[model samples]
Target: MTAINLAKDGLWKNNPALVQLLGLCPLLATSNSFATSLGLGLTTLAVLTLSNFTISLVRGLLDEETRLPVQILVIATFVTLADLSLQYWFFDMHQRIGLFVALIVTNCTLLGRAEAFASKNPIISSTFDGLMMGTGFLLVLLLMGTIREVAGNGTLFTNLHLLTGTPDMSIQLADSGFLLLALPPGAFLTLGCLIACKNVIDGALR
Candidate 1:
């Protein structure tokens, strides 16, 4: 596929979180607040890009029987590095979503891209694909976080300083808001609405 097509597919047509429905565990768990969502999103993005590049670099050298195992090891290495970097640099954020950070290894989105795209594509293309896919996932997490945080807590970016070391950027919209949107069931409902919206938009385009 051309670069444009790859970008389009990853960002919109085949988004891992919104469309492909991969990595829902972390996506739903960490998307309760913008700060937490941003933390996990960036970590996942870094690990995805690095692992994809490394896997593509060694694709030709890997045996068919060992490819999956090698890919897991590469992903694990990056996850470990990402985990350490977060703990050292963003200890507060790490404490909030540290468990999910380690769970990036189990995210099928990373492994699926490694096996299906990285293994067959050139390093540059694989890296680009990873970036696009990771960005797509990040965008979804951000949207969900924004929706839930605003609707549930009546605040946006409360504690965003945890991620961006800035003065508090939060804006309180109300004293309080819907309690359901801040909970787990709210995640499912919001995601379903997002999917429906995407489908409607796609249909209109078609």
Candidate 2:
């Protein structure tokens, strides 16, 4: 597929979070707040892109049996780097979602892309695909986090300083917000609404 098609598929047509639902564990867990969501999203993006590029570069050397293991090793290496970097640079943020960072190795989105796209494609195409797919996942996390934060906390960007190293950037929207949205049940409800909206939009476009 062309670059444009790849971008479209990753960002919308086949979003890892929204459509493929590949990494919902981290997506839902870290999406309670915007700062946590962005932190995990960016880390996942970096790991995904780098792992794809690395896997594509070495795809020719691997036989069918060892491919999955090698791809996973590449992904794990990147995830470790990301986790350590976050711990060193953004200790507070890392403390919030560091486990999730490590769990990126198990995220199906990374492995699926490595197996389905990167292994079969050229380096440039594979890298771009990873970047786009990661961005799509990040956007979905951001949206989910934004909705949950606003509805549950009555604020946006609460605890954002953990990621930005700046003063608190939260903007309070109300005196109080819905308590349910701050809980696990809220994640499911919000995701359901988002999927429904995407389907409606797609249907309209068609």
| lDDT of candidate 1 over 62-151, digit per residue (tens) | 998999999999999999999999999999888899999999999999999999999999999999999999999999999999999999
How do the residues 56-175 of candidate 2 rate in per-residue lDDT, one tens digit apiece?
999999999999999999999999999889989999998889889988998999999999999999999999999999999999999999999999989999889988889989899998
Clashing pairs in 2: none
Error of 2 at 124 (Å): 0.4
Which residue window of length 10 is worst by lDDT in model 1? Answer: 159-168
TM-score of 2: 0.98
Global lDDT scores for all candidate models: 0.94, 0.94
Clashes of 2: 0
Note each model's CA RMSD in angstroms.
0.7, 0.7
List ranges where model 1 is wrong by over 4 Å.
none
TM-scores across all candidates? 0.98, 0.98
